[model samples]
Target: SERIFENEKVTVDTIPLSHRVYTNGFLFREKPKELGLNVDAVKKYGIDISHYHNIKKGKDVLLDDGSLIPNSELTFPPQKVKSYAFCSDTAYEPGIIPFVSDADVMYHDATFLENEKHLAEKTGHSTAIEAAKIAKEAQVGQLILGHFSTRYTNTDQFLEEALTEFQNTSLARDGKVFEW
Candidate 1:
């Protein structure tokens, strides 16, 4: 519900989630980086390293000869920015759509299957389909379902049901590691 960290490079924010107790999710977003310097262009222009800072900051350079060099010609675009969202120990909570919309990746709680919807509701947890619906509504790049109930003998249904709504959904396991 509030931003916890921020600088020129990135930001981290908390999102309130529907749970029996006080619960929150997190959203981590990387800011657009400075433009990359075209070393070949710099060398070709005979520009000194002293002007590197200003050029990267998007400033045009004025040569000693009074010739002007555009910043666009000195630097290329930056890398793509990325965002991540984490929601757990919570219910279907569609109210969080705005905060997580367009996230590159999202990890959501899916503690039950559709057959146990009543149990999940009572426990303030979400079913696999509900998590997938949230991911689809938010248009997130990927959905990671986790926090399963111990009673379930198999987790295939979770991935299966979630995939029906969001094709990029994946299951989270105890020792599993995810990148991007």
Candidate 2:
């Protein structure tokens, strides 16, 4: 799915202002030797995340570790960067704030309401309220909620729930442009 786009690529590091790196997971794992960069370089840029990979292991790796290996050096340009974090179907992980802090925009999957919180956790997805909580804690410029659960007939509830925590929140539409 990440490989679907090979256009307009940039780097992502632990800091909001560091020399960005390309999508290492799609680039490195597929053709590292072809690119003449070692797989280690991808790890250096905090690209090959294990949290989403090892979610079933019952380990809060992203929490204990901040996306990158400790003591690693990765510098990315702070300016001229648009960080898009597709936190697809994840539980409430507060530790991720630092890594995603100050993103120009963030798309968090809000698939349930507070009343259906149990379903959210069970499905490995976050409630609209939780998504707002993350956007607020991360201090992202804007929060876009999507991936609505099938049970939800109207998307207004998603916006309503998120607004309770983060004021700058909006429901994601099929085709839309959110200017910074």
Candidate 3:
């Protein structure tokens, strides 16, 4: 499930002339509920959400032992994502790997180089090296990093660091596009 924290501005809408709805938002929230939904946007775009899983609340997800979780009353089988991009800033999070693994394309936030790791962490962000680690674990075919901090005047350092862990990783610009 997408775990949206307080103060996060999450939104979902269908796009015009598409069979699948589009999702854009911060990485913290989950989008299973919105993906593939046949909404106004989808109709406008000629898209469909029939393949997307609807959201469900969990009941007794935690087990008595606390170490194991009972069946997630809440779960969405991964639909045909084709591509998945996690945006904005976030800290090193290993837990997200399962959710993003095997995605055709994955976008992760690499806000800083290694030297600024402490500052990154302090601000709830991640360094380029850390973002690559997540991409590697996720095994995504392509990884695009973005959400740069203003202080970063050059991005070569970010690319170098990310390549150390994930060879397919690259930087994202304001208006770049990738066709599946």
Candidate 4:
């Protein structure tokens, strides 16, 4: 249940999950860009604004004094793009493992405890353990368990359960801020 929308510069994937009816999760990613001109290097080389675009596109620039400034000297290496995946209100879906593999951060549904796994399955939700298993299998940098069931009074158990499989697992709460 995945649909992909892509162009020359970006790709957005919508993953539809099985809930009581149908729900979708999205993954957004940026395409790699050409080497960009280093501002300091541009200033050092006394390059004009007109040649800035050319240097960013990896083209050498010709100086007014009949000297050639190599593109390598004017531009910096491209930066690595970070990726994130959000699994919204899904069951223990192994099918999505490939799409979200090796993501920098992953947020998955953890709506119930292991004791209530039957209810979680019936409602098309996942327990903390299930979410952690998915994170482990995907090899994500960080695993965030969210969407806890309101029936639970203490949510610390969710984090504890998730930690059994993925040491990097964390429980998400309202107003909680996560930094990469």
| Local distance difference test scores for all models | 0.95, 0.62, 0.60, 0.86
Indicate which candidate wins on lDDT.
1
Give the Cα-based TM-score of candidate 4 against the true structure. 0.82
Backbone clashes (count) for model 4 = 0
- Give the top-scoring candidate (TM-score): 1
How would you encode candidate 4's per-residue C-alpha lDDT over 62-171 as one tens digit per residue? 89999998999988887766677889899988888887888878899999999999999999999999999989999989998999989999999999999999999888
lDDT of 1 at 22: 93
Q: Per-residue lDDT for 1-180 in model 2, tens only?
A: 234443334543322211122221111111111112233544555454543333222222333355633222222222354556656556666756766677767877788899999887676667899889988998988888988988878989889889999999988888887776
* Clash number for candidate 1: 1
Better of 1 and 2 by TM-score: 1
Q: What ranking emerges by TM-score with the best candidate at the front? A: 1, 4, 2, 3
Residue 168, candidate 4: Cα error in Å is 2.3
Where model 2 places Cα greater than 4 Å from the true spot, the runs are: 1-9, 13-80
Error of 1 at 67 (Å): 1.6
lDDT of 3 by residue, 1-180 (tens): 444443323332211111122333333333343222323432443323432232223222332346333223234333543445464456777766766667667677687789988887777677888888988887888888888888878877789899999998778877878766
Cα lDDT, model 2, residue 153: 88
Clashing pairs in 1: 1-14
- Looking at model 4, the pairs that clash are none
Prediction RMSDs, each to the true structure = 1.1, 17.3, 15.3, 2.8
Model 4 residue 78 CA deviation in Å: 3.0
